[model samples]
Target: MRASDRAYATLLDEIQSGSLPPGAVLAEVEQASRLGVSRTPLREALGRLGADGLVVQQSPRVTVVADIDAGDIRELFELRRALEETAARLAAVRGDAAAFADLAGEFAAVTLGDADGLDTYYALIARFDAALDAAVANDYLIAALRTVRTHLVRVRRLARDNPQRLAASVAEHRLIASAIGARDADLAAHATHVHLHNALESVLASLGGGTTTGGAITTQGAA
Candidate 1:
């Protein structure tokens, strides 16, 4: 990565890892010093972050990171579920053979209980999602899914705490990949909904009654 890109990636990593947090005001000088980069490159980094919806820009001030709330997380997940269900259905019908091949490999890696495969699993998920999104071929659905992904990233960290849930998620990913490979739109949509529903349950369980920001957690197996 270029110097500016490196700095930008570093900041984004910190943000996603919960080190910077939502609503935290970051001083450019401190960030530049911390990242061992010049202020100019740091500024460039922040600009890109802003564009990615990871940061917010305002008049007469440096950009600020967006604040996350339970409502925001909940709504984002809801949108993701809706959009992805549609995308999976379309991808199944369209039969993008190359993308399906890639997704199959990712699904295999995710099903394996190896430590190093986790990152690869997530990367495969991103690629799978992008491919599905492309197959959907609706600009509005594509745009909405992008917004939902930004906030859903926050809750994703919580998902790591539950091994069983993660394994289940991988299984669900495999189902969608396989179903899409078979050109089964109905099955793809159903599998996508089922997986996302379980994920929502897991996330809600993790945040249950912790704070007002995490929202409602069902003790009665709501899923």
Candidate 2:
């Protein structure tokens, strides 16, 4: 990769992994020198991130990462419920055999799932979910999925670490896959929503008194 691309990726990875945290300021000149890239390409990379809502640049003043809190997570999930349901429904209706195969491929991966530790299951799901997003064939729906995908990344790890949740999640996706395979729009949407709803409740309970960020395990929400 080019120097600027490398710098951009490194910075983005740091931010997403929570190392850089949020609202961290970055300057073009400093980062270019640090990443061993010229200002022009670094600026281009930053511009891309800015469009992705990962960065905010204000002229010559400063650039900083956008930060979202627990409240933001709640909002993000709410949007996910709406947008993802619509996407699932569309996938069920419009998804061809190729889409079914794609969903099935992801469904197969869950059988190898490990509940004890973090795995790339979440990333795999993202790819599966992306298929549905594309199947929606609607720009608005696709755009929303692109936006919400980032916020869901962290919560996905915590949620999947729960043993019961891992199995339940697999079952949920299977149902979604089945519905889509059957070409039943309503069923697909309903299955997806039910899965997400169950997850929200389980996760809220797992999180206890804290936000979805979950500082500790506790008994709360619903059983």
Candidate 3:
């Protein structure tokens, strides 16, 4: 991989995993040395991260990880609802029913009692997302959804402590896949709406009754 690509992937993973939390300073010289890259590639990586809204440049030489609060989560969910609901409806009409049926069966058998099980469950969700993207067959919509999902990784990490919510999400995904497999567009869309609603509520509650912009949760700094 290109040095810029490598740096971007490492930084993106750190950001999503909370190894580099919000408002973390990212000094180019320090980060470049730590990542074994020169300043040029590190700057390129930071530029891409800024474009992704995962980082913000406070000055020509200062960049910090972006802050995410309850309001940001709400706004993200709003876009997620629009895109995912529409995707479900379209997939119901145009997707491969058998594939969704298989996914639904996998969701039904999901067991998240262990770390490995959780990994499997998340992999299944990834497959479901891939199937949704393929079934929709709209590049524009898929691109927009991809952007939403990028920030969603950070939000989702906040909710990982709640096994109850994760279990509920499994059931919700099953219903969505089942509805699409049955070719019921209305039901599929409605199910997606419900799932997103529940997910947003869970994430907000996990944030200690919803943090605000003025008083956001703070974590460790990143490179």
Candidate 4:
């Protein structure tokens, strides 16, 4: 990978993992040296991040990670609902029934026990997402979903493991997959909506009721 891509990937991972929490300042010189990259490449990486809405420029020489809150989460879910429900409906119409049936079986078999277990569950979800994308076969729709997923990684970090939520999510995904396999467009869309609603509520509750734009923004000094 190019130096800038390397930097961007590293920084993106850090940001999503909460190592570089919301509002964290990413000084050009400091990050460049830390990542062993020169200023030019670091700047390029920051520019890309800014474009992704993961960071924002405060002034000529200042930038910081963007803030996220309950309001932002709600907006994100709104978009998610539209995209995912459409994807599910399309998948129900165009997807391979046998493939989706297999996926539903996998979801039924998932058991989130430890960290490794949760990782496995997430990997399964990724597979489901990939299948949905492939089934839809619409470049524009897939692109929009990708953008939503980028922010979703960071949003997911706000919530810890709730066994009940995880279990419910598994059942919801299973139902969605089964509905698609059955070619039930209406059921697939409704299942996706219910899953998102429950997910949003769970994430907000995890944030001690809800988050705001209050503490997620910080300004850095311009050089």
lDDT of each: 0.75, 0.70, 0.90, 0.89
> TM-score-based ranking, best first?
3, 4, 1, 2
Cα lDDT of model 1 by residue, 1-223, tens digit: 7889999888888888888877777688888898899999998999888877778865546667777555555666667877888888878887686678668767866644676767777887888778877787888888888767766776686334677877888888888888888888898899998887777767766765322223343343322
For candidate 3, the 10 contiguous residues with the lowest summed lDDT are 214-223
Most lDDT-accurate candidate: 3
Task: Give TM per candidate.
Answer: 0.73, 0.73, 0.92, 0.92
Clash count list over all predictions: 0, 0, 0, 0
**Over 4 Å off in model 4, which ranges?**
210-223
Q: Indicate whether candidate 2 or candidate 3 has the larger lDDT.
A: 3
**lDDT winner, 3 or 4:** 3
Candidate 1 Cα RMSD after full superposition onto the native fold (Å): 4.9
Q: Give a tens-digit lDDT track for model 4, residues 20-120.
A: 88888899999999999999999999999998889988778788988887777778888998999999999999999889999999999897976588888
Better of 1 and 4 by TM-score: 4
Q: Please list the residue runs of candidate 2 whose C-alpha ends up more than 4 Å from where it truly belongs after superposition.
A: 1-4, 56-60, 97-109, 112-120, 154-160, 201-223
On residues 69-104, what C-alpha lDDT tens digit does candidate 2 reach at each position?
445556667888888888887788887756676666
Q: 9 in model 2: Cα distance from truth in Å?
A: 2.8
- Candidate 3's residue-wise lDDT over 1-223, tens digit each? 9999999999999999999999999998899999999999999999999999999988887899999987788889889989999999999999999999999999999999975998999899999999999999999999999999999999988665688988999999999999999999999999998888778767887776642332233222211
Worst 10 residues of 4 by lDDT: 214-223
> Model 2 — which ten-residue stretch has the worst lDDT?
214-223
